[model samples]
Target: MTRPSPAPLRVLDLTDDLGAHAARLFVGTGADVVRLERAGTGAARSRAEELHWHAGKRVQRIADEAVLDARIAELAAGADVVLESGPTSRLRTPALREADPSVWADVVHVLVTPFGRTGPRRDWLADDVVLSAAGGMAWLGGDPGAAPEPPPRQQAEQLAGAHAAIGAWLALLARDRTGSGQLVEVSAQEAVAATLETGAIAWIHGRSVPGRTSGIYGHVAHRVFPAADGHVAGGYSGSPRMWDDLLAWMVETGEAEDLAEPQWQDGEHRWSGRPHVDEVVARFAARRSVAEIAEQGRTRALPWAEVAPPSRLVENPQLAHRDFMVEIDAPEGRLHDVGLPFESPALPRPVRLAAPADLPAGAGWAQGRAPVTTRVPRPGTPRHGGALEGVRVLDLTWVLAGPYVTKTFADHGAEIVKVESSQRKDPTRFAPGMRLRPGASYDDSGYFLNFNRGKRSLALNLRTSRGQELLRALVPHVDVVVENFSPGVLARWDLAYDQLRDLNPEVVLVSMAGVGQDGPWRSAVTFADTLAAMSGLTYETGSATRPPQGLTFGLGDMVAANAAVAAALERLHRGEGGHVDLSQLEAMAAALGPAALEAELGQTVRPRSTVMRCAGEDRWLAVGACPADELDAAVRALGAGSLADLAAASDADELAGRLQALGVPAYAVRDGHDLVEVDPQLAARGFYTPLDHPIAGPVLHEGLVEHLEATPGALRTPAPLLGQHTEELLTELLGLDPAELNTLHEEGVLQ
Candidate 1:
């Protein structure tokens, strides 16, 4: 029997550059998105920009203001969702619902702006660069002595779009349960602020602020090493095995000099003696090609990656093997762009529809009066429980991406069983110098603590048959299973989606791999830095004159985590579970849609410029496109006759405050330390919550990114110790007897 097609969501997209990616996400997810533009409007700066954002959407131009309002009211009267991205004055949520009460009763309205709808800075004029500076990201890039660099492309705008997508999905889920729609408000500044990695948390709890580095943070050996052909991002930190492997590789190449001494054997000692280790590694790398290092290092589990550019990514072997890039025919020619971040059996493969043909010169306005008839069924109340309250997740993920996804679920009241093994612990647990205090154990690393919060630890060695049985036993009680191992690792242990389905028919399996499950490079190992390089982010992150640099740590991991949450929530709303194959490379690429579109269209992708500078050491600003008068006022407020004079001032924050008070789009560049104690806005909004840890005392945790008034999420517990709840979880969920557990422990199957 032929199955009926899935119902398409009706989405009305009224957004500019700020919300283009959000609308693109809707289109990718099979939404019937209709774009509403002004008649004769030419807002797109270039043809490439126009095609990059507007292609694959049905467009309708409205000439009269009253007619536009009526058209929106008519569309909203039947649409499932309405997305707006301009200022609040242009598209207010209250005004949209008021336009036609009955028709808009159940339509989700999403608002994306620089700030929020109600705030002191709500009406302030800003752009992507300005928002990045305000969010403290700008302050964390570039060299410590140089001006902080803003990430290339519109990252703040793209991040806001990502958050908006998550918010939209959350609202849709809520609507499905209560038969009511809501306003999913997103702030560009706040969205970027939340993804600042460990900087903000460090400042609030550890009283330490992170600064700009040449490459990865924390480790002295983690930096870009110049190779014969290009550069490779070296990530030899966290584990003694990695450090030893790097030294061995160098020794094999005859580059290890005095550094091969027994004194440098310890990972901690090697870090302290990094000058000698770096000298040897750099010499060895300079003699070899990036390909050689990447290929050889991966075989030995060394986290080394070739720094790649967007153009290079176009021909990446791993990405090509996964068919990560989709070829589309455009006016110019055939172009390639990234596809959806994940592939799920329950969701159809996303197809980019061809751009609409040009409208006739005299397109009549009367065509806008068409009646709306489509109506989505009000889904039954969610049986999965209260906003994820009773959901149970089996978290077999480690490090950043997978743990981040489970952390979100845990925050919203999901029970998360974080499975690990003492034999091969999470690298983050042993990350050097990230401990809360000196002489702290593996579980005391701040990096591990931050990501593993609200999870119960269940240490079971998956290598053992009994351990595999124990995991299979618990699968029936879990609503979801998430992991981020290299593609084939889980399947090797018979824990693949196909295997789990026999135990729990409704279980959702989310696998976050660097490439994907069925790709040629599925077995390629990856870290956050390598994923960035492969995804074309590291290529476009730095200044045009300099070699490409990476963004704040684990950018790809964070983006994939957000996408994972949306995917899980979406499946839960549908009341059906299936495999979700999420690629970290694709997730980060999705956030760079604008750049991908431009590159595919053969446009000259220019590097972002550093605009504003402030007085003080390493203080810079990213004041996008401020009005001429406001710029002038800002210069005058600094009491400087010239830019040089402004740069010589003693305090940039004080000057920024004065300019901000004068209604100028300006902000002082802030490092993690600066934001912890100084960001009044984040404090006012309660973006930090204190959680009591048994050993660390009261530690502050980051707050939720999205706000759902009816069911806001919370951080309920601290991070668990290694195997802290193994006995409890085994007894309660798997009904394992004490004798069996003791036997398992004696057999080394359970830690």
Candidate 2:
């Protein structure tokens, strides 16, 4: 019996490690992934790299570049999309294109490279560490006096892959309307540069350069605290109520000490009293068991979790309850892995794994569209303009993932109305990582200002029935609605998916949370750091001798944000209204790449590649994951005797150039100052846009991570002030009278 493929989309994947994550995600979305490999290539994929990412993809090996090009032309005739990575693609090379004209105007071409396709360093040698430095990520990590660090392993590559997926999906969404395919180019350096958790904002918004700390971003309120059993991540002081409850907990345990004092009681001073607060929290948490602390957190509805490693994945109660863990039998042995990132009735088979396709020799590999599962029919709407100009989004979300998701939409010309409340404001408006202005108003948060750009604020208190009624009225006017409250919060507010569907049958809605919409831990309060710790990302960081380290930024949040963005775009493209239950943890676990497999195969290393010192105080060069032969060559070229002597004598910038000249992957660990003032690649690519905010004054903001040749996205506005567009949006979208608005405000329903 032959079962037809579930998905209709056909992808010719010509990418290596650079685009592996995107291909893996496409497979999960039910696309038919056909991977092309060079016949004589020595290093196509390491065993560890190929473990889980290529489980269900089809493959063919070609002899040389000529044969590969010919095969691509032959297979690409039936393919809808082509995924290419690296700088040597023949598609863009004018010198070689004249020999073979394969100008594909019908198929979407997604190019993922270290730098952009046209940057000054586009053809320069690249590795993960090089991207981290060039992207300004390395500067934000490590201790103040130590060398900067990159996120462990191939995270830089994977981040680019995630962006590539979004770019490809967006292009295809546009194609469904315009019947044209164009270029979607993703720069890994820019992807990392854009997701620095406000790393560059201090320098961009002002002249002050922010320094690195130990894992914690800006304030020490949120971090991995040591537990009696292991480690648990919990520390959030953004909300006054959350701080009061934490203080009450400490006071109950007779451990509040100075925290109960007048000086330390104010939540605003939490940033300044970091040493004392961290000390008190550490003392309170060190003696408690992980289970005990977790129970306490649950009782208080605090965002906290155990710093779980890959080995602990199987033991996760949430995974067990959701049935997320899967077992696959291969030629080697039985292996355990995770499932899809989101669940939707809209997708018949969101995930299906089969043994690698075995086509007989001389048989064609062309399998035409089957079942049409990847995308739904295009919406029945007239096109107004290009670049998402007609889309409307109601963003009932706060903090990282939700706001970032809306930001993606808003930057691309979609109108987004972000909801907030006077009583319950977005916590990010307060202690959102690093801040550009000290003790400024709610508008000064670098994180809020950056992610909330191009969005309009609609302050409404959902607790009131009048407020809920107003929200219900606004639902019919928007194309899509997104929220990231805990599992049942929307249901309590009478705005669940079913209710939203009742309001507007064709409106697309996405409900994203930490665990999922339904699970044993669905009610678990979570933060971005909690997702990172639980997804095995934190366990693989740091040196082998030290305790495990967490990433400097919200890696998990970024992954979930892009996934949600893609889902919303897909749903809107199809013109269908459906519910999407996305687990931020599951999305992050997929980004774990081969780490889980490595842990299973006992090949896991405490990554955090070697950060070697260079000349000048604390200046360093990152030498990450070099092959044995290359490592030997680097040592010989640099005269390796004592690391201490080399640290004092070597110039990182010069040595990085020298090492790259010898085919070794090396680059300087850049700080914010270097990224803004010295990095030529960023300047040449125009990665940063200096925008003047009404309140924040002039600031350089991160632009889009990828490019769309047909219709590129732009930064339209700065972050909105609270209730900035309340009256205008209501009057414009809902036809609400000024008298009604005045009544709502007087009745305390509107903020």
Candidate 3:
């Protein structure tokens, strides 16, 4: 079999840490990435950071401003994309845009900033913590009574980078058709805010604001429990089968108490009885080692994971088996860091490319080719006529990560066939505290309704041979197959990538397992929190005085979902089809790339900043360094003599607004309520769309994160009910007779 050619594109990276991940992603997809640095700039803050973000990219140093401007214009004329963070002083110049209109028009200029370029907070200076607080993410973690804490490391910056990467890819697809590249603006605050799961939607629809608590919200038994040897994170299921399995395991160890009662059979009752359940589980866990719990959990198919620090992550068996860690030899020394977020046979391997010996002067403008001719499809056509139109996706993913990946495709006009089974439905369908309507059924879950919009459902029980046969028949028709089941589940059902490839020669399969497919710990069960704990994110989050805690939301799931989308799109762009093994743990670790670099270089990773509280319950501010002029202006705006006086103020939003107007970055810690009610920027951008569902009526759902001008994505349909389109799909796609479908339904093979 012949492999598809790599994407032949040139990217100019003129960014600090903010947009590094975007350029890094382009490099991973086999683009020729060139890094431009100032002449007086020192080496990367650490050698490990440089190797992780810039290993395969060429670099050039330019000194004189005039020379730099001319070089940038020349490069812009030849480059396919230019990634820059902070102010766009160089890009907005007439000299660059006018040097070659055709060339400039074809080059995608991605501007990544703390806030979007046209927003009021655009010029405000912000670090990771400030951006997180401004985005309402900080309000989701830490104790309820104490000030909210931002996740450790630069998650806001990385999330922005991920969105920027997605935007760039979408633009490239558009350029492939339209021959015109547009600006892809990414705001760290907006990107992080979108990852708050259902918090924003809950406030918009339910008029209730959720605050940070001891454990993940809505999950009482899902927390890191102390084990004999070390800590282990575990989550109990609300499903009766899993709950019974857990109880049986406890009974085996003589740890079952009140949980053995008949009243505890109901999942809701078990949740309400969390106090008793936690005591019983803790007693059982304290006497058992982490290894023992891990084994038992795997045997019972329970969600359990051992809490791993950075050192353990370095030696993790699952990561090692999947080859998720790559070793690089930089000028400083040898270092090991997280590798590609996902692995694909068609994707290019990482290569070491040295920087250019001499900078190119302004001489290549006349030799550049005219922009490629392409056309964008019109909206409201079949498949919404968006970028990925005509592509067919078979979505077998449940919960956040897998559904989120397919949601991107569905939003971008791909025809998605979501194959769920009534036997093992998506947990989001039963997510606690989220109901579409009073007395709604299982399919009317608010979480499900939000995450699974714009897809057709084919609920089939894969355990049945006939149902598996039907799925096998559908595999040949789909362009891509996505699943997030544990490693061996599909293989057990004879529906793994190897089997699907035999049916469809060019089928692209994306398997997003928690630990990947072939690792030793691949069989270990995991949840969003467990993945965070095992990836060292939970260990690094929280203050120095507090024990390590996981993010209140599924941070790892969002990161992995974005990566999965990028992988699928890259394959489609290259006209290649192959299996993509995506490890959620690796995805989370890649987001913490800089921190890993620091640890690899024997440097202390910075701790979370202290929160500065003000008026309103849980209202606080995250302050970072600011320019002297901005600082002085902020003091004047707040009517204070010094920074200390402003910090002591009772009203945080007032001070934040005054400082923001003065071009200083300070934001009041916003909860879900603030985002829904007061976030004018999000409202102006139409980030939240009020989509009407049959069950949920009108609920506000998050809009597209990537803004494509020519072929913008949109929500076209509400989530499907269980087996809602069974008859339609069978008749239209499978050519199945009505009587045959009725027989299958009667046999309990189809729901």
Candidate 3 per-residue lDDT, tens place, 1-751, comes to 3244443677888877677788878766767677777776535355556667787677777778777777677687778888887543333333466666676787887778776765555566677788888788888888878878887777877888888888887777767666677777777778888888866866765566777875554543588787898777886754566677888988877788777888988777878877788788888899999888877787777888777777566687777766666666665655676677765443343433332234364334223444465543323235564767767889999888999999888888788899988788566775546553345567777678778899999989887899988988888778889999878888888888888888887788899988877766777677788888778788776445766667767778899999998887776655557788888888887776756667767776544444687765556877655556767776876677877566666687777776666666677787888887787767766777777777667777777776665677788888888889888887777899989998998988896
Residue-level lDDT for 178 in candidate 2: 63
Winner on TM-score (1 vs 2): 2
lDDT of each: 0.71, 0.73, 0.74
Encode model 1's per-residue lDDT on 55-94: one tens digit a residue.
6667788788777777777677667778888655566445
Top candidate, metric lDDT: 3
TM-score of each: 0.89, 0.90, 0.90
List runs of model 3 lying over 4 Å from the truth: 1-3, 39-44, 87-95, 119-123, 178-180, 228-230, 238-242, 245-266, 288-292, 344-383, 436-438, 606-610, 627-633, 641-645, 648-650, 737-740
lDDT, residue 115, candidate 1? 70
Error of 2 at 294 (Å): 2.2
> Which candidate, 1 or 3, would have the higher lDDT against the true structure?
3
Q: Point out where model 2 deviates above 4 Å.
A: 1-7, 40-46, 89-103, 247-264, 268-271, 344-352, 358-366, 369-386, 430-435, 605-609, 624-650
- Using lDDT as the measure, what is the rank order of every candidate, best first? 3, 2, 1
C-alpha-based local distance difference test score of model 2: 0.73
